[model samples]
Structure formats: structure tokens, C-alpha cells
Target: MILHFLGSRGCIDQRSSRHWRHSAMMITQGRERILVDCGEDWLDELDSLRPDAVILTHAHPDHTGGLERGAPCPVWATPGCWQSLDALPVAERRLLHPGQPTAVAALQLTPCPLAHSVRAPAVGLLLDEGAHRIFYSPDVAELSDPATTLRDVSLYIGDGASFDASLLRVENGNLCGHAPIPSQLDWCAAACVKRALFTHCGEEIVSGSHEEMNKRLENLGKERGIEAALAFDGLEVKF
Candidate 1:
């Protein structure tokens, strides 16, 4: 599987040449092309990417607003996510169930509930092709089932709203906001996942100096016994 980070900026006004667009990613396996999240920033250029399908994580504008003008391909999301995207005239709308792996094209995707928005529920995806497995969650507070979701995961991609400080909040006993980077890295260590990449960048990463930020993540990865790296727009990795 080949993963591409099309956008990385979080919900912030801050922007830079390297990480200006909202969070989105493209997955490619042979001739199959799958896009994850289509933020408003990607609307104008989405067609050019030519994905076979679009998988949404949540209903947030930064994650689904790109389809406001209708999608060029099939759109897949959980029931909660469809509630927010029903107004769009997408060609095909598929409902994804948490824990039930859905085969699309040539890959398998299993959604896992995430603690992000109560009003607009979110899910992280476990993508697999035979023995290769990867977990992707651009905006997450907590995983509903870490034992199964993180099991045998080769790579973990996650939120990067804050580097070290806590940004999580409780809303009517529900968790919202992104977990700190250090805490996420700790999750990677516990999961026994040897590699991790962070996207959905916030000011701490977009506005701060790149060299300093990379060094911080590098040192953290070294201590955690995992390979950690910050994802930037247009960044691509093959697994």
C-alpha cells in the first residue's frame, strides 16, 4: 500500500508553504485509488486526484466540506457521518460499520469508533491488504477498542493538534479535541507499532520552526522505541 498525505493542517488559521491545506490522504494499491477525507481546501483540486472512492472520518468541515459540490466518486462513511453529508449529490453513498471490514476495490477497511465529536461522531479506519495493515485517524480523542484496532498494525497515522500540552476536553462526559503528540506516541509504544506518522497539524507544528519540531519528534521516537515523523502536504510513503 502507498499512502499520500495530500493535506495536513488542522483547524487553525495558521498556514505555511509545507502544511497549508486541511487534513486529507490518498491510498493507492495497484490500480485502486482511495481518498480519505476531502476538506474544503481540496474541493477545487479533488477531481484531479481521480480517486475511485472517498472515505470520510467525520462530518467536520475540514474533513467533508470538499464534497459540498458533489463527489466525483462513491462516498463512504459511517451512519453518523452520512447524517452530515446527506445533502450532497454524491454518485454513490456507502455506509461503513465499525469493526466490520468492508472490501472496496482491492483493500479492506474496518471502521473503529473514536471519541471526537458527540454531535458528529467520528471513526478511525484500519486498512488492510492481506498481511499489511495500517491505522488512520486524523482527528481523534480516544479509540473505542484499542485492543482490536491496534492489533498487528504496521503503521499508525494520527492527529497532531498539540505536541506536549493537553488539548483534550470533556463535553457532557464525551471526549473532544486532539490528544497531545507525546501521548499518542505513547499509544504507539504500547501497541507495539514500530512506526508512526502524525497529520492534522496545529499551530505548534505549522507555525513553529520545522527543524525544532522534527528534532522534538525524533527525540520522542527514540525514547519510545518507535520511528515517529511529522507528515507534510504532498508527503508520500509506501508500505
Candidate 2:
């Protein structure tokens, strides 16, 4: 399995030097490309990658930004996600019913819930075969899935929007609900994750030096004794 990230920016796409990251990801697992998310401006990239399945974790605009780019092959999302995505006029809106096994480009995937700040319950996908498993999660407060769904996962990706709890609560202050990076790590460790990744970062993250953030995450990983890395746009991972 190979993971190709076309864009990794979290929410909004503020095109500055620090935040060039888009918000698209493509996974080439079974000869076909399985696209995870596609922001609006990612049409150019999608035009190149004719994906077999476009999986949607949530109905947020940054995640569904480029839905019209494709003729709409197989778009997977939770039932709530479907309710939220009612505005989009797509060819197919396959509802991701929990615990149901579905095919995504030759690989079987299961949908699990990830409690998020949005009106709809967010999702965390487990794409696996008889042996290998890859947990793909974005835009959530923490890992809110049932334990059986995430046992001994090989790769884990999650939302890490802010640097700390203080910033999470204080970011623009009036902005109600959001989770931070440190809190996200807390959830990952409790989940007993293997080879974890922190993505869906806020704009402040891009502005601050990744080196500094990397240092902190490195220390956290050492303390927890687990594998973790910061996710970036255009990053390619071969499993």
C-alpha cells in the first residue's frame, strides 16, 4: 500500500508561503487509487489521479472541496455525513454504515465513529486485508471508535489541529469547540496505536516552524514509547 498526499492542510486554504499545503490524499493499495479527501482547489491534482473510490471522512468543505472534479465513482461517508453532504449533487453517495464491510479498490474497509466538533459524528476508517490494517482518521476530537475496530493497526492518521490545550480553547477565543495537538496525542496513546501520524493541522501550525513541533512530538513519542510523525502535503508513505 502506498499513501500519496496531494494536500494536507486542515481547514481553510490560506495560500501563503507557510501554508501551501492543499488537502487531498490518494492511496494506491490495489492497482487502483483510493482518494481519502479532496479540497476545492485540488481539481488539478484529481484531473491527474483518476481514483477508483473517493472516501469522505466528513462533509466539511475542505474535505469535500473537489467533489465535482470526478464523475463521482464511489463516494463513501457516514450516514450523518450523507445528511450533512445533502447540498452536494454527486453521482453516488454511498453511506458508511458502522461495522459494515465495504470494498475500496480491492481492499475491505470498515467505518468507525470519531467524535468531532461538527453537527455530524466524524468517522475513522479501517482499511485492511486478512493481515494488514491501516487506520485513516481526520478532523476529530479524539479516537472515539470501539476498541475491537482498532486493535493492532499498522498505520494511524488523526486530527491534530492546535499545538496545545491552551491554544485550542483560546484560538480566536470566541470560536466555541475544537481539540488541540497534545490532547490528540493523549487519545492516540490511550488507543494503543502503532505508527501514528498527526495531520489536519491549523494555520498556526504551518506558520510555526515544523522543526519545533517535531521536537515536541518526538519527545512525546519517546515518553509514550510509540511511533509518531507529523503529516505534510505531498508526503508519500509506502506500507
Candidate 2 Cα lDDT to native: 0.69
Query: Candidate 2 on 1-239: residue-level lDDT in tens?
Result: 78886766777545434346555678887688888877676656665678888888777777776775454477878788878776676777677787788886676888876656456556778878556787777676555443455687767776656666443322232322356766655655666765677777676666677888767776776676667777877788886
To one decimal, what is the Cα RMSD in angstroms of model 2 from the true structure?
3.6
lDDT of each: 0.87, 0.69
Best by lDDT: 1
Question: In candidate 1, which residue pairs get closer than 3 Å at backbone N, Cα or C atoms, i.e. clash?
Answer: none
All-Cα superposition RMSD per candidate: 1.2, 3.6
Against the true structure, candidate 1 has what lDDT?
A: 0.87
Question: Which candidate tops TM-score?
Answer: 1
